[model samples]
Target chain A: MIVAERKPLDEIEAMLASAERVLVVGCGTCVAVCMAGGEKEVELLASELRMRAQASGQRRRIDQVTLTRQCDREYLDALAAYVEEYDVLLSTACGAGVQLLAERFDGKLILPALNTRFIGTAEGPGVWSQRCLACGQCLLHLTGGVCPVTRCPKNLLNGPCGGTNHGKCEVNPENDCAWTLIYRRLEKLGRLDLLDAIQPPKDYRPMTKPARLVHPAFQTESAPPTK
Target chain B: MKDSIACLGTETEGTGSGAFEPKVVAFCCTYCAYTAADLAGAMRLEYPPNVRVVQVLCSGKVEAEWLLRAFEEGADAVYVAGCALGDCHFLEGNRQALRTVAYAKRLLAEVGLEPERLEFFHIPASAGTLFAQRAREMTDRARRLGPSPLRSKQAVESRKLVLPPDPHPPLPPAQLGRRIRESEEL
Candidate 1:
């Protein structure tokens, strides 16, 4: 899922200084699960802005609303009515949701309230750690479900580097070496022999490209008659 | 004679007769505290009428700024009531609520307001009597403490600031660059 973190309050306050009517839009999907942009966050931010305005003796009118999924057009339609009521829209969604809101609103001033982080999962309650770089490839099968591309500082795909000491990464002693985790998993699965196989340099073409997806079901209807 | 009149005026002001009734804002979780308050009303339980309850989807929805704003806007007391631990409708909402409230207490103390003015309670929705009891207790405590010094009549009237919906929007690339530079220098 898309992971994100809330921008500082002072930073957000400066963004809406020019607008009188502002709308805070939150997404209830991936961003919500990560606790970045969600219904609760929207209300908290709205109240904060109101308080700041009162303290600063500034006249501002802020409103908040949340949608099921900001990236989906169907869910974004729920914001149509509320959208017209504000001069600016603050989206607490992931990067995709922020872009989607900008595209849907077109001429309106749209802003992101979160810093899009990475594709990750909750390590524990209130903690989300990066797990994937989404390099348009999966090498986890050979690495025991751990992605060195994200966990390793150098994104190494092979065995442990010299920087690894006592199963911990030298760069961050607190973090366990990804290679160590991979080795233990491989050893448990009786696939330690696979580690000896030398991996060639990965293709950079897939990582450098823009996002793309293909589905066979969707292709059939769009494909024209073949000669 | 003028001196005697001035002394009498000072005495009258010090007595604080006809002082404004303290305004208390309570953020109640809908699943528990709010329902409990509703039950209190239905049961015809008499508690202080000073509190104005704002029903939020969850106690976690209550922000620290809201509590500060309540005080800034002339609320002598602010209370947040949520479900007991492990009983939140949206699991961990109460826990987060507790943390936020604790933070607000420290912040309030730092700002010269009595930290005791802010309170947090965890009660089940079925505990209507407890809700009433807590409400009355808070009101009495606030009454004894009197109005917050920061909540003078002028301060109350001055709190009519109109906030823009998104008071702080994300800065454009240019402004962000300037901000980063400023921070680095600092």
Candidate 2:
């Protein structure tokens, strides 16, 4: 899932310094699961803003709303009814969700409240570790299940580079060497021979910026005329 | 004092002549702190009435939003009173509440509010005296801090203009007890 963390309160407050009526929009999806932006987080933020405004003797109106998923047009449409009620919409969704919301609202101000971190998985309670870089390649069959693109600082394809210090990355001693983990997993699976095959340089073409993909069935104007 | 600043949705107690009386919201775990409050009452202990005890199944059930709500709703101070460490009825519920309180304090600080206004207290069910002491401690701290800056002039004016509905209407205990007994007998 896409991981995100809320921007600092001061930064968010500064974003709304000129705006009197602010609507905080939350996404009940990936960011929600990560505890960055959810219904509860939205409420907490709204409450904080309201209190802060009142405390500072500033008369500001703050409200909160959570959409099922901000990236989808259907969910974004729900805001159209009351979109005019606020001067600004502060979105607490991932970058895609925030951008889509802005696009859907067109002409309205939509500011992000969270820093989209990475495509990652939960490591433990309140801890998440990046697992995928979405490099548009799958080399997991070659190297255990870990992706060197994300876990490795240098993104080395076949690496136990000079920076591998006793199974730990020299860049950060706390991080386990990605290649070391791959080797041990392969060794345990009795597939050490797989490591002998030299892997080529990664192709970055598919990962070009602003990548868009349409399903093969939807690529053409007409769908596959009813099965 | 009441003339100068009206109540802002918070139940203010002992509105002593012109002196500030802090309103505190205490989330009390039923297994420990809530029962301790009852014991304090039975013992006729003298404790400040500033605290409004909200009984929860466990302190762990108190979410960060709830703590934030207390402040937003005009609580001058707020606290979560749970079982002593390792003495929680649900094993680690108190520990969870501790972490939650710490997180809430950070949020309070982030919002530019004094984190000292929020606290976590560990009081076993047997510690009635301790519960009262904690209550007094919070009350004194709130008194020292004075009223929350969040209690804006608007809240004061709104309170004067509109009277909110009674959240908990007085329940006649005699009739309530008879009704419960009748249902049980039936």
lDDT (C-alpha, whole model) for all candidates: 0.77, 0.84
Tell me each candidate's TM-score: 0.66, 0.88
lDDT of 1 at B132: 88
- Scored by lDDT, model 2 comes in at 0.84
DockQ class, candidate 2: incorrect
What is every candidate's C-alpha DockQ against the true complex, given to 2 decimals? 0.06, 0.19
Candidate 2 stretches greater than 4 Å from native: A221-227, B1-16, B155-186
B1-186, model 2: which lDDT tens digit per residue?
121112336344446576777888888999999999999999999899788888899999988878876787678999999999889999999999999999999999999889999999999898989999999999999989988887533531111011133233334557889999999999
- What are the per-residue Cα lDDT tens digits for candidate 1 across B1-186? 123212221222322577556666678999999999999989998877777777888999887767776675567788999999999999999999999999778656644568899999997899889998888878887888887755543331222122234322333567778999999999
TM-score of A-chain in each prediction? 0.93, 0.95
Cα deviation at A52, candidate 2, in Å, is 0.9
The TM-score of predicted model 1 comes to: 0.66
Candidate 2, pairs of clashing residues: none
